[model samples]
Target: MTDKSKKVTENSDFIITLNSLTRFVLGAVGGYNMQTKLKGVREMNDGSIFNSSHTLEIEKDLLLFFNTWVDIQGDKFSNDRKGFQLVTTLIQALGLVFHHIWHCCSNMSKTERTHQIYIAAKKLAQINYSRDAEHWKNCSFLTLNEDDLNYKVNSGGSTTRKHFARYLCSKIGFNY
Candidate 1:
């Protein structure tokens, strides 16, 4: 294989390794229970403290994963294309995960989790818009269009501002 391809493969392997380690750590730290609670929120509108606890646990895991990845790859990348691609992929994964968490939280009965989700979403949107308004200028991934906005207003949770922020964070590599 070519040198660049080899490098990409190596980087990808490293990322996979890191992902596995993070999952392991999360599992050890009661991530499974958190995941179950998140699933429960999605399946049922039960707004319990379990949901809040799960959200907090997942959030902590996300922060740790990002910090660890950055620490390992920060100096090694140095503007390299492969490194940039890796970082971007990681960010996208993070945003997607956060969006899913938000969705789960939103599913809960109007309670603290729901409120937290709304607040988090708003924060994410603000951060994205502030960092680069242009990134969302022409994007239509999540009902950014006028029609979509009107539709969402009519149907709640169809498209959330928080999910949009998560997407922007993923795209722009915002260290949230």
Candidate 2:
């Protein structure tokens, strides 16, 4: 085979190995419930559990995996930039999955919401390295700023909103 073909085969093998390792880790972590649900989806026509309430445990594990993967990818960047990008994209995809899960769980019980939020915060703490932390922090900062502004406007406090916006902009290094 050509050199390019060999590289492709090697990459595929690496991905398979990584996937096997992930499954093993998840299994060891007591992921039987998730595995069963996934198996149900594949084996039954109406077995999909798309709602968050029904898949809370699985979502929690997925969240944990995504956060851990991002940290690992950040470390890998020191050795390989392209590989880092691929892993980073995978992390982003996980975040998207979490967003969907959150939407599905929105109407769930308060206890469930609290549990998911706690999991999210814990996972976020793992993102302490530079690349991952920067992205996550910026997203959080923007979200907070938007929420603050909305709250101020809804509460009928233009002056306070302006002051808060100014403070946030300055803190974020925004000129003018």
Candidate 3:
């Protein structure tokens, strides 16, 4: 079968690449409604957060659809600006999606496995590790072998905002 026909497997590197591309794409559409909604989140003095769950659901759907569309197109647009833009949009959507997913995981009670996944996703987001670094720092952890959950917590913030995206896929079954 052609590579395009085969399913894309889940992996940290791919997700990170997608996230970076997404962030770049967001730059092109800075005033987008979704972007505005994400940036408009408000926290009140009484500790109540005012945000739209409807918007979050829209973001989630967009992310899923964009990623799936990319998979459907495969490498056909790989060598052009459209390809770059598409990838960027897909990645940026991924970062937003995961950002929200982490929040959802945080607010809900979960199974031990899911909770552990959430913790890793949190640390991964905190460290801002590149996918390679994320792989080095937490691949094993992601696989359930770590004794210390806070391992990536103390790392520098120079890491890219890609780990949560990766974690969403590898740990939480976010198929592209």
Instruction: Using lDDT, give the best candidate's number.
Output: 1
Tens-digit lDDT track for model 2 on 25-105?
A: 323222223322323332222455334354454555555544554455455423433231233222222333343434455
Error in Å for residue 155 of model 1? 17
The better-scoring model by TM-score among 2 and 3 is 3
lDDT of 3 by residue, 77-133 (tens): 232322222233334534444445444455555454355444443433333222223
- lDDT ranking from best candidate downward: 1, 3, 2
Instruction: Kindly list the per-residue Cα lDDT of model 1 for residues 35-121, writing each as its tens digit.
Output: 222222332234344324554645653554445444544444333433222332333433444545545555566456545544444
Clashing residue pairs, candidate 3? Answer: 18-91, 21-88, 22-91, 22-92, 128-159, 128-160
Query: Scored by CA lDDT, what does every candidate get?
Result: 0.38, 0.35, 0.37
Q: How high is each candidate's TM-score?
A: 0.24, 0.22, 0.24
Per-residue lDDT of 1 in model 1: 16
* lDDT score, candidate 3, position 158: 18
What is the overall TM-score of model 3 with all chains considered together? 0.24
Q: How accurate locally is residue 65 in candidate 1, as Cα lDDT from 0 to 100? A: 40
Candidate 1 TM-score, true structure as reference: 0.24
